[model samples]
Target: MENSIQSIPQNWYLILSSFMFCIGIMGVLFRRNAIIILMCIELMLNAVNLLLVSFSSYAGNAEGQVFVFFIMVVAAAEVAVGLALLVSIYRNIASTDINILSKMKW
Candidate 1:
């Protein structure tokens, strides 16, 4: 069991996480749609979660995994609230574009 775990290098995990986070950042910055941006944020969170799990396993400790759980909880709440807000905005404007959000004010 232990040898199976150690086969992959820690560097690969770091690289993969960094790549995921960068993609998320790019999506959030370049995408105009609210839903796509929200999904990107989720991607970023998952990348961090992956990194945390990898470190926890490599270190033979549970602390990083615990942090990942807390992050997951927060991410879930964020998605719930974010989607609700998006739905409300879409109903009012009939669109989900971020630039049009300026018109959201009464």
Candidate 2:
């Protein structure tokens, strides 16, 4: 069983993960709303997480899973902080437009 599992090439996983990452990149590039952009960032993180998990599984190690857990924690914290910042911006600007956020430049 272990030999069979190990025989599966890593490139296949890499290709799929790369595809997901590209899609996430496109979403971030095309989205105009702050919320949507945040979601795209999350998507990208998830894609990378998938790749990490796959690699960890291939290596027969638990470290990848542990790293994934930490990534989830950081991603959650980012979402919380990002949404709060968005709310603060919306309170003052009344819009979530990414373009309009440029005015906040200090």
Candidate 3:
């Protein structure tokens, strides 16, 4: 039983993370909504975080986990700033579409 718990193969983790990252990339590429794009970016970040955690656990080390924590912090800050900008943009343009942003100029 003890060995079974630690026997999870790394390939599973790799496959899962890669799939998630690909989905995120697809979302970013195909979506026109700013909020959805932001969510997709978050998904990509989380996919990388998952990969880091899997590697850390497999290697018996904490460094990857520490890096994940930093990434989380940065992601939080990014969301805050991104949402604030989105709110302001929405107030001005009355829409969340990314194409409208190209017409904006100071």
Candidate 4:
């Protein structure tokens, strides 16, 4: 069983991560909703985390996993701040559309 698991090619993981990253990029580029864009950004981050973990496992190293841990922490902080901003924007504008944010003035 272990052998079978180990027999999987690293390239497959790379390909999968690449596809996910591309999807995330598309979502961010095409979506007009602030929440959707944030979700896409999280998707992209997760894709990177997946790639890091796969490479770390393949290389028999712990560094990548440790980096992933820090990335997760940063991502969490980013989400908290981002969500707070979104809430404030929604409260002020009564909408979550990114396009409307351009008209925001001090």
> Mind giving the per-residue lDDT tens digits that candidate 2 earns over 1-106?
7476577799988998889899989998998999998998999899899899998988889999999999999999999999999999999999999888785688
Error (Å) of candidate 3 at residue 49 is 0.3
Model 2 worst lDDT window (10 residues): 1-10
Across 1-106, the per-residue lDDT of candidate 1 in tens digits comes to 7597778899999999999999999999999999999999999999999999999999999999999999999999999999999999899899999998875676
lDDT of 3: 0.95
Q: Each model's TM-score, in the order given? A: 0.92, 0.88, 0.91, 0.92
Ranking by TM-score: 4, 1, 3, 2
Pick by TM-score: 1 or 4, better one: 4
| CA displacement after TM-score superposition, residue 11 of candidate 1 (Å) | 0.4
Each model's C-alpha lDDT? 0.95, 0.92, 0.95, 0.95
- Best of the candidates, TM-score: 4
lDDT of 4 at 46: 96
lDDT per residue (tens digit) for residues 1-106 in model 3: 7675377899899999999999999999999999999999999999999999999988889999999999999999999999999999999999999988885566
Clashing pairs in 1: none
What is candidate 4's lDDT per residue for 3-82, written digit by digit as tens?
Answer: 75498999999999999999999999999999999999999999999999999989999999999999999999999999
TM-score of 3: 0.91
